[model samples]
Target chain A: MANLTTKIGNLTLKNPVITASGTFGYGEEYLDFLDINQLGGICVKGTTLHRREGNPYPRMAETPSGMLNAVGLQNKGVDYFINTIYPRLKVFETAFIVNVSGSTLEDYIETAEKINSLSSIPAIELNISCPNVKQGGMAFGVDKDMAAEVVKEVRKVYHKTLIVKLSPNVTDIISIAEAVEHEGADAVSLINTLLGMAIDAETQKPLLSTITGGLSGPCVKPIALRMVWQVAHAVKIPVVGMGGISNARDAIEFFLAGATAIEVGTANFIDPAVSLQVIQGIDDYLQRHHCESIIDIIGALKTA
Target chain B: MKKFIGNLVVSENIPLKNNHFLLKLTQAEPLPLMLPGQFVQLKIDDTPSVFLRRTFSINYVDRLKNEIWLLIQVVGDGTRSLSKNKTGDSLNLIYPLGNSFSMPTATQSRLLLIGGGVGVAPLLFLGAILAEKGFSPSFLIGARNVDGLIELEEFQKFGNVYVTTEDGSAGEIGFVTNHSILKNTFDKIYTCGPTPMMQAVTQFAENKSIDSEVSLENKMACGIGACLCCVTQTHQGNQCVCTDGPVFNTKELVWQI
Candidate 1:
């Protein structure tokens, strides 16, 4: 039997299939379909300091082999998560990571501080790269200095595993990843949705209400794998690779490109059981190669 | 609500109109309790263009025979793929999702169920359950012309069926609102159809001071609440149509009408 266990900072996961934030709700919604505890980790929806109503109607548009979303971090705030959501999630056996988003540096620290106080939540994925939000999201992620500054501030308040999510909209994604790692980020996850827009031909108008939205799905996989490969080589911290991963074969590619763990995003909408299948596929690959542990395959890609 | 994911064998595929077909699927296991306004997500096969599951409201369900029926209108690639299904073929479905229409109470005997085009699908199930509950509800359906109408006999089995077509080829000569059935006061009104028709029904119900509910047809990805794509704005803010509801009380909706 192959050992699927892997470590991300201080945390140890049974597998490498964590449900991406924004796709998996608060972890309770999918409990009826599959065992939430079986997943490597569950990154709950992007939580903000204050309750947000999100963007207006027609926030999503379907693209070929992918989808565009401008859901502007619509969450009920950190207080609701602590007061109501946290208690309900405490019983889960797997790791529960909060994907924290904010408009300002103070909002990020405050949100991180509150989550740090929770004993059950072992990590928080700092969402400095959400492209849909109008104000702070992509702004910090695009610039190396801004990205490092946000991670530097949150690292002071957040005591647990800190993973900074990087945006693909930037020119030098590796620079931003290295900057955050230099500022005490325990781990890094990339790449957040690429910025793209669609137009309705008949109406001659933008498909999404926001005009432009973040694009995600199989369409963005090649770019995501390249970025993950580059960042893993540049930084010593663990890297979580995710972008358009739909099946086990797609996930194996991420591991080969150097991801300590993988997050299943839009694929959850296509198949809720995709993460479980991905875990099994990874185990099968390990067995076929006569490898005893998944660590043997991390960044195993051989190039000319 | 109980949710099931099973391979349902196609028992029958009855064509209703030029574009509509009634697909009856039976599972080996006993059918779970299903309510009106609830829907099932059907997985599309042999189509790379369509990746998401297609959501359809329950047209009818026969628990005794372990059968579930879906009224599919060939609109796009997804439904077009479903229309090609033959008897004995198996379909994977995730079912009994979303909330149901509010059942009429003992005092609220006079009920009105309205539908337009393919939107009349769920109303058949609603009318069937209401009839079984001892309420003889009236059903008003609208289409472009006589040929556009579907499953009139099935609807008639539960209540007095009234229909209106733009070309006067059916029961009445205008929109469903133009039908004389509006003259009779109903205790409660339930509707699902074109947005314009539903809005008209809501306005008529509002004028008569009658309680009204509507099921919206938003473009959805996951019929389960996991994907927050299918959202409807209500008095309480944005709610997932797949989970919070495909059905909502008219008073709760923030529609201008």
Candidate 2:
């Protein structure tokens, strides 16, 4: 059997498959769909210091092969999750990562500190690249200076492995990846939803209540793959890639592109069991290729 | 694998006098255990342009034969596409989402059911429950015109049916609150529909100090509270409609309209 176990920075994952933040919510959402403990890990919904109401109506719109959303990091705040959600997640058998977001550098550090105190949550994915919220998230992610500052600040208080998620909306994504890498980030995840929109032609207005939202799904696979390959080569830390990856073929491509781990997004909206399928697909692919360990193919892309 | 258990096609998609339509979904799932005001997310496949599921309150659920009915209006491309689903076609559905209206408990007897526009869906089911329990209920259905009303005849058995239209094309002209039926107080009042209509009912209930519960319609994703899109202000603070409630006590809701 191929060894799927791998390390992201200082942390070790039993497998290379993970569910993207925001898309997977808490692992409980998929309990009826599949056994969450059987997978590598699940990145929970983005959490903050306080509860958020999110955006207004028509916050989501579907594009050509993807869907756009401006959910604005609506969560019950960290205190609620620690008190309410954390205990339940502890028993899931596998270590689960919590995806954290914030409105300011201080806000980011505060959330990281709070999460670090918990025992069950093994790591944190800094979602510095969400395009929907009005404040600190994508703002910090887009600029190399702020991204480094936020990561450095959070790193000081957070003892857990930190996976800084990068945004695709930037002009040069590799530069941002370098900044976070310099700030002591343990790993990096890329290609949060791309900024996109839809319009009601008859009304001559944007279809979404927010006018523009983040796009995800099969349409973004090619661009996301290119960015992941670029970042994987740019940073020494492992890169967790996600975008329009809906199946096993997509996951394997990311692994070959140098991604240490892959997150499955958008496909959760289509079918909740997609993460399980991706895991199974990777297992099947490994058997077919006669690979002994998944590490053998991590970044094994051949150059022409 | 979350296979498509059933693919219901649009059987009859006729525009009601109001912008809403009376849709008959073919290949629909045997109706699940849905109470009134509970809704289903319809994957309207008529157009490739809109892929997000459009949610509709389950107007009726017949579990024995396993069929569900929805009253949808052509509000947008997604909804417009829903109006195009016809007989023999498959429509993907995620059912019985959102919390249902609280059925009348031991303390309540007389139930006042109010509905506006396509909001009457769950109220009918509520009315049916009331009838089965031997409680006589009064129903007030509000629409833009008389033609907007659906399943009115079926409701006659549940209670005294009252209709209100904005253009004066039905039983009573003006808004649903314009009907004299609302003037009378009952043990408990239940409603669903446009914000203005529910707001008016809430106001009337508050003024009368009558305990009333209203089912709100908010745009949602994940319909299971995973996405915090469908939240409403309440005296207790903000609550997700998908989990906390699609149904809320009128007194608890912070009504804008």
Candidate 3:
């Protein structure tokens, strides 16, 4: 059998098939569909220092082969998780890496510091790339200095693995990746939804309440793959690639392009058990290729 | 125990009045326990234009025969595409996704169920369950015209059915709110339909001091509450229509009553 275990920073994932932040919903939502402990990890919804109501209704709309969402990270605050949700999730066998986001440098550090105390949570996917919120997140993610500054500050109070998630709506993603790597980031994940918009021509209005929302799913796969291939080669730290990873074949392309692990996003809404299928499919591909482990295929893409 | 994702084989696709279709689906195993007023997230296959899963109320479930029914209205590309599904085609969906209607506390409590447009989908099941429990319930259905009326026979099986059409082509000859039956005393009311109609029903219930619940429909993605797209404001806060409810008590909703 092919070994499927992969590592992001020092945290060892059972497999490379983790659920994306907003897509997975604390891993409890999929309990009816699949076993939550089987995945490599699950990034629960984005948590901030305070509760967010998020955007108004019509926060999401379906584009061609993709979807746009402006959920704005509506969470009940990190304390709520630590109080009510964490007790339930702490016993899970898989890695419960919290995705922390905020509107200020203080918010990020404070949120990260709070998560640092949770023993069961192995890491925090620092979300400096949320495009939906009005402030902070995407602003920092698109800039190298701001990204590095936030990571460096959070690194002081946060003792666990610090994985910085990057935004794709930028001029030079490589600089941002290297900057975070320079600031002691354990690993980097890209590309957070591409910024896009959709309009209802019949109604003569924008489809989303926010007008512009994050574009994700298979439509953004090729662009995400290219960015991952570039950053995986450019940075020394591990790359956790995830844009439109719905199946194992799409996941394999990320591994070949040089992702140490991957996260499944919007596809979870379509099929609750997709991550499990992805894990099984990856193992099947490895056995078919006679590869002993996943490391053999990492960054092994052939280019003439 | 709550919900399951399954591929249901299309057993029958019965076209109804208007641009609606009654889709009967079954699987190899017995259908999961689904409550009346709960919904399903249907996955559209081979349709390039429709990318997201569409949400529908659990129109009816046949336990003995192991079948589920969906009342879909062809309002857009997604519904039109789903209407094209033929018998034996596999349709994947996540069922029993949201909360169900809470039954009345007192036995023989006067109950009225109002459904409009395709929102009438779930009331048939709710009325059937209420009748099974020995409660005498009444149904007031509204439509734009006679063509908009659907499944009158099915609803008649469980309750006294009342209807109104805007064009006066059906019962009462006006909106459902204009029906003469609203004068009668009732303990509680359950309604699902166009927002304006539901709002009117709620106001009437509030004025009568009768408890009422209304099911809301909104633009949704990931009908499991993770996406947070399908939300409605309430006294507590903004709640996801997909999870917290597609059914909410009239008093809890922020809409003016």
DockQ for all models:
0.60, 0.29, 0.83
Flag the better candidate by lDDT, 1 or 3.
Answer: 3
The C-alpha stretches of model 1 lying farther than 4 A from their native spots are none
The better-scoring model by DockQ among 1 and 3 is 3
Q: What tens-digit string does per-residue lDDT give for candidate 2 at B96-210? A: 6767778777988878898887788788778887788799999989887777787788678789998888998878888877788766768898988888888888888777777
**Stretches of model 2 off by over 4 angstroms after superposition:** A1-3, A50-58, A62-64, A196-212, A288-293, A300-303, B1-32, B44-46, B76-91
Give the lDDT of residue A59 in candidate 1: 78
TM-score of each: 0.98, 0.89, 0.98
- How big is the positional error of residue A55 in model 1, measured in Å on the Cα after superposition? 0.9
Give the TM-score of chain B in candidate 1: 0.98
Residue B5 accuracy (lDDT) in model 3: 82
TM-score of chain B taken alone, candidate 2: 0.87
Residue lDDT tens for model 3, B1-257:
47888789999999887899999999998787899889998998788999889999988888888988999999989899889989999988888789999999864299999999999999988998999999889999999999899999999999899999999998988888999989898999999999999999999999888899998888888888887888888888889998999899999999943
Error of 2 at A194 (Å): 3.0
lDDT by residue for model 1 over A131-216, one digit each (tens)? 98889988999999999999999999999999999999988998999999999999999989999999989999998888999999
| Consecutive 10-residue window with the lowest summed lDDT within model 3 chain B | B99-108
State the lDDT at B190 in candidate 3. 97
- Tens-place lDDT per residue, model 1, B80-167, is 8899889999998888899999998777999999999999999999999999988999999899999889999999999999999999
